[model samples]
Target chain A: MAGNREFANRRLHSLLGVIPLGIFVIQHLVVNHYATNGVESFNKAANFMGGLPFRIFLETFIIFLPLAYHAIYGIYIAFTAKNNVGRYSYFRNWMFMLQRLTGIITLIFVAWHLWETRIAAARGSDVNFDMMSNILDNPFMVAFYIIGIVSTTFHFANGLWSFAVTWGLTISPRAQRITTYVTMVIFVALSYVGISAILAFV
Target chain B: MAENKNVRFIITRQDNPDSAPYQVEFVLPYRPNMNVISALMEIRRNPVQANGDKTAPITWDMNCLEEVCGACSMVINGKPRQACTALVDQLEQPIRLEPMRTFPVIRDLQVDRSRMFDSLKKVKAWIPIDGTYDLGPGPRMPERKRQWAYELSKCMTCGVCLEACPNVNSSSDYIGPQPLSQVRLFNAHPTGAMNAPERLNAIMGDGGIASCGMSQNCVQSCPKGIPLTTSIAALNRDTTIQSFRNFFGSDR
Candidate 1:
């Protein structure tokens, strides 16, 4: 009985890990839009974000807390999950596997990115609002950013389309079609915003 | 027309997951009122291809022999659906019989579904009744709520949805739509709701709900047409609220 309960707990934890992480991914993409305005603008925006109380709280809770919990728990989920191979023939299955694999890649990318950029701000260096722009100005970073954006966008968009189903917003075939279109639009919009920012630096 | 004699079949066969799958042709005697499953039965009984060559018995899996069990799902023509429900009269030849590639083939059409089963286990997709005592009829459910729960009860673990899902394949750990939907179903039950938190937690884990790159194919392909995406959407909200609870450190 206890064992079953423990098993149940693990399941719910994994389910919870997706949502905040998903929302965080969106929030980060939206925030990255600041980079399009120039390095100074991006840097200034990051710094200015430290000022507001709710923003600070959000950073701590919404941004950092959920992100950390989601990631750590995510790792736990990955290790525990079975190697479910050959269960599907759908192209989406390949993409599904791709989504999970890319998530890990993107997660690592974000950590390195923060270590290089935002964490550097702790040392009281001169504010460069265009620092984000400067990074994109580099070819390697540009490639990394592009790959990151594409993978993140694909992961989120697909996940969001499913999320619509999970949340009961799309209940039937008609609703599913509408939700698919909506998800497609959202993916395009988010991509547009993300790509527009990155292109500004180029 | 006295008779249009040839029963043309286009079958997609794979020897292994990594193998290059190929198509083969077969012809069966046109029997009156034949169904896809019935046609398959004839092919299996004869084990012959269109060229009159005796070959391996065409491989597939079914139990209960009825659509109610959902065990005989496969792609007919171009659609992922239950073969038992596919009537030959309605189908255009050459009829197609392909393994749902969304899964790994154990032989021909039989693919391993341990993953979907494991997902249900991971999410604790069941009510906890070990039978210590009667427990006095358990908990009561309202009629409307019971009706909704009834809809969720239709899942036969067919895995057509997982096969249809873009996220659940050999390369990914995303448990796919059926398990996630089961979580929603069990969580909604009055007796089952006791473990709702645990069910939510399961989906939140690795290859959990986050892994769903929802292409909406599962929703479209489901034979029972279970509102899969709907379950996923509800899970999103439930998990989000769960996150807030975790954030505030509240059990309530």
Candidate 2:
């Protein structure tokens, strides 16, 4: 009974990890796409966001909360997880580790992002759209952004697709397939916009 | 059939998780009675390809050479199976060996399987047994229940169900079948039955049995031949009862 509850608890944590983090990634991507508008326009969005009252306080809480909830709990669950009990496919397994790996990567990416943008701005030298444009113009940053957006989209959409299973939404084979395709479409679409934005800048 | 002198093995190779993957071919001396794992060991020992060029030894995961461990699982031809049990006598020639694409190639054949474990954790797929006191014998399981429950308990966490499960891909949160069977195992136990509602409720909820795609591959692909679909079907009933209990405020 005790063992069961702990396992149950980990699953709950995994569930929690996805909810806030998944929502946050999607919303963040939406805001990030504003960069396609170029420096003045992009910072216009950033400055406007900064202008919102109590925005910093909200940011302060969210900045650390999701990754913390996702990673720590994720590790707890992953450590306790079972292995090789049945025949697993190449696709199923790849998606699994990639999600966790990408989760770690995204966390690191977000922290550095805050350092570059939020922390720098708070110190009176934030890298705004102009600075972002300049930095993004660099091949390294561009590569990072491109890889970041791809994995981020993979993370968010896949999280939702998995969320359906985790949440008991996709029960049948048909539902699973539909869910799979739906997530595929989401990434493909997100990729189109995200990649094209980067390419246009280049 | 004469031991054909011309047999080919195409293998994917990587030095480590950090290294890029590549493929190498080998023309093995067609020994009578060789299995894929034995062949792998041969390649590891020799570290040479068909062209007779020296090559890095290929990396793979294995544990019990017996199929019981389930760690030796990989795609032979197209099916995911234990390399230990996969025999050359039964296989077609020019065997194409690939790491299970369903997993991240840690080096070559060893994929990180933490996700499967996490799914099991998510479902509370264990009998809660905490030992600190000298308690008397636990509740005895009926022979009939134990017979099938033993089967459910046989999950080695091999991940075949995850591979077969369309819902359980790199992108989704579906925990797959092995864990679902575990819930059935624990919930049916007398003392374990105490947490039946909790287990049923968990699987019924997010990443629960409801996430099961019901492809039936889990039943067929299970090396132990555990009746996974049956457990899932039973779970369907159990979760329904749980929902009713929830609706009536009686899910105790």
Expressed as tens digits, the lDDT of each residue in A45-70 for candidate 2 is: 77777687988666655546656766
- Residues B1-252 of candidate 1: C-alpha lDDT, one tens digit per residue: 426665788888777667787888888878777887788789888988878788877677788766888777787876767888888888888888888777777766666766777777888988997777777777788899788778888999887887666556555667788888888888888899988888876777767776654555676678776877677767877876665565577855
User: Per-candidate TM vs. native?
Assistant: 0.63, 0.55
Report the poorest 10 consecutive residues by lDDT, candidate 1 chain A.
A1-10
- Candidate 2, residues B1-252, lDDT tens digits: the string is 555675689887776777887888988777878899889898888888899999878788899998887787887876777889988989887897877767777887888777778777777777777878876778888999888788787888887767765556655556788888888888888988987887776776655665453445666677888877667766766665666577578625
For candidate 2, the TM-score of chain A alone versus the native chain A is 0.80
Model 2 chain A weakest lDDT span, ten residues long = A77-86
> A88-128 in candidate 1: lDDT tens per residue?
44454454466566667767877877776657766654435
Task: Supply candidate 2's per-residue lDDT for B189.
Answer: 89
How well does model 2 score by local distance difference test?
0.70
